[model samples]
Target: MSNNVVPAIINLDVKGPVISRHLYGHFAEHLGRCIYGGFYVGEDSDLPNEGGIRLDVVEALRALDIPNLRWPGGCFADEYHWMDGIGPKDERPAMVNTHWGNVEENNHFGTHEFMALCELLGADPYVSGNVGSGTVREMSDWVEYLTREGDSPMVRLRKANGREEPWRVPFWGLGNEAWGCGGNMTAQQYAAEARRFGTYCRDHGDNKLYRVAAGANSFDLAWTETLMKQLGELGCAYRPTGYMQALSVHYYTVSGPWRDKGDATVFGTDDYYRTMLQAARVDELLTGHSNVMDCYDPGKNVGLVLDEWGTWWNVEPGTNPGFLYQQNTLRDALVASLHFDVFHRHADRLVMANIAQTVNVLQAMILTDPDSGALVLTPTYHVFEMNKGHQDAASLRVDLPSGVPTREVESKELATVSVSASRKDGRVLVSLSNLDAGQAADVELDLRGGAVTGVSARILTAGELQTHNTPDAPDAVAPRAHDQVTATASGLRVHLPAHSFVTVEAALA
Candidate 1:
């Protein structure tokens, strides 16, 4: 370890955009066990449930105070038919889930179940309407079915399915990935389709829909440019409209190429560092997409939604290849922390980001065992819980004056530390991550502008980078009370361990 301590500054007076609580959102797709076994174990199961929804899963996710949950898919949303999933569970027709394993989907958990799940979690619903195979009327009727009142046909159908009142679906996704799985359409094609489809998705009374068009595939700037060129302007005024309020992007952190994304728990320091490097690329991705959006909407009216993101690794051994189930480790937690740091930095343009999935899938917060219905909160979950205080908080400017710590790996320099801060209610929350695998460092936070009365903190790290929680040892990589931070004269001095993520909560005067 170097004797020279790294210095970072956080000016409490420098107020930035409100880090949308929606930025700390989650995704739950119908793929894999993310739905059927992970969240819904049937109403008659021994595991306690609320109307077929797992109580344990809901109770666990409730800790994060999750703001919004995007539903029915990455590719599944584009192919899904809402009518098939609603109505009585038994009577609902079954179909082949061609995207994620050729398993039978009984359409058990549909619109009602999802809304019920949202009610259980107190989160807003971000419904992803089908665009690839669904028609304009299909998507329009879905919005009405969930949000409309009075004697409408869609409302009558919703009532017949047992829902009396309307649901507040504030965020709606126009489609998933349009260039690939959503449908192999060109940028120009999807933009036109989105404009047409979005036109019919009415607000339906007080339920205002923020329609998000399926945006770029990673750093595909042309796709974003086309969307802005086509949908960014509404009529001759060139004004922003609710028809296309945001654009969605999907990026996953993988250690290797897509053919083989390295094992989740069987990675060395080199693999870990490479993963961190890939995770850090989100800053570049956001900035690139934001630059394009700036050309059309300089006021930042249209938001950029990183709706699908997180670590994607090969499925667990023996699991279905298409299921995308993987283990979450200390490395995964650090990746999440890194992404949140970048997300905070781009809060002006970035509005919401859902970590690939919430349960039993890629970079899941909670992993459920199919046999016993036991739930193991992954290390990534701790990052969310510890940093929940930053939600809806005013973002604070954090600057590194002593130069960012960097480590050269595989001929590339990787930033070893990431930091972000925010102030909420009279408290300031600072989140930091040390991405180094074997070196601990001392960091002095030169805090200015406000008087901090006292500070308390927590740290999440394990003995190794790959250390993860299993049902047998759930706390293997869980967070513990951190006492390494001392109140210095100007601010606070913190000692960050290798491959660790920490959050500091300070009472401001």
Candidate 2:
């Protein structure tokens, strides 16, 4: 630690936007074991099952209070056909997942199964409709099957299939990555298609749908500009019956190019620093995309949905390369904390964001080993679990004193510390991360509006940057009670360890 470097002071004011619970959302694709072996172990499996869904995974996810879960994919959603996955598990048609591992998808976990899993986790289901290889009628009927109550063809089919009551699916994605895997269409083409698909995706009774249009890929400002401009023009000229409620963006932190995304667990300090810098680019991406959105929708009518954001790395050695199965480490915890801070800072425009996956995938929350019946919660999971208090809480404006640690690597500026705070139920919850891999931070809080009487915290840190939990060592990197927080006369004081994520809850004096 530099003696000349001043301690970071976080000033929190109560007047700010309310952090959306949806911001802490998660994503699940049909890739690898994320759905099959990760969450669903089949009804007949001896390893604890709830109608085929893994009970341990459900219990862990429920504990995190996961707000929403986007289902069936990254690129998989655009290729999925809702009809083939319904009816009976044994009779469902099997298709090759060309986008992912090229493995055969048995279609066992369909709409009903996903809804049942959501019910088990107490999470809202955000279904991504197939627009690339599917029809508008197909998309409409899928929505009707899940939300429609009255007599309809889809409703009748749904009832005949066994579920009498319609599941409340409020969030629907029009497409996923339309510019790439989703038909490779131009922005104008996708915008028109989005309008068409969204028009027929009706709201059943009180189930108002929040339709999210497939948005830009990372820093592709041109894609965002073209889509928003085309949508605006369409609305003005044709006065479209249905419009986009949100524009979805996808960004992942990779250490290198597409082919060589570095390793998930084996990395040094420099690699960790570089990864943090890449994750920090999310702020720039959000800023650029939001600025483009402001041009088309000044009132911010349509929110920016970061439906897919997390660290993507090379697959674990010896695993199927296409599976995208990787281990999560403390480095991932820092990345998650940094991203969450950025989301809260831009909560007004950034309505929702889902981490890349929930389990047995990129930056997964839970790692399941069915062979051994071992379920491991990653450091990333502990970050989400600790920061759960921020859900639906009113965001507090935080002003950090200048002179915070900043590094310039590869022409990018990365901050060593990331912070976000919120007030809910008369308790102020602050989440902080020390991105520095070498030095701990003595951070001081300058609270406004009221004095803090008591302080309690949970911290997730490891002795090494690559520290992670394996099946045999599941408790290796779990969160522990933070005893470094103490109430100060002015506000509160916290000792933030190096490369650590901490969540502190303070009660007003």
Candidate 1, poorest ten consecutive residues by summed lDDT: 231-240
lDDT of 1 by residue, 269-305 (tens): 8888889989999999999999988888888888999
Which runs in model 1 stand beyond 4 Å of their true positions? Answer: 1-4, 232-238
Residue 51 lDDT (model 2): 84
Q: Report the C-alpha lDDT of model 2 over 121-239, residue by residue, as the tens digit.
A: 89999999999999999999898899989898988999999999989998999999999998799888998998899889998989999999999888989888876775565232333
For candidate 1, what's the RMSD? 1.5
> Lowest lDDT 10-mer window, candidate 2?
233-242
Best by TM-score: 1
Screening candidate 2 with a backbone cut-off below 3 angstroms (N, C-alpha, C), the clashing residue pairs are: none
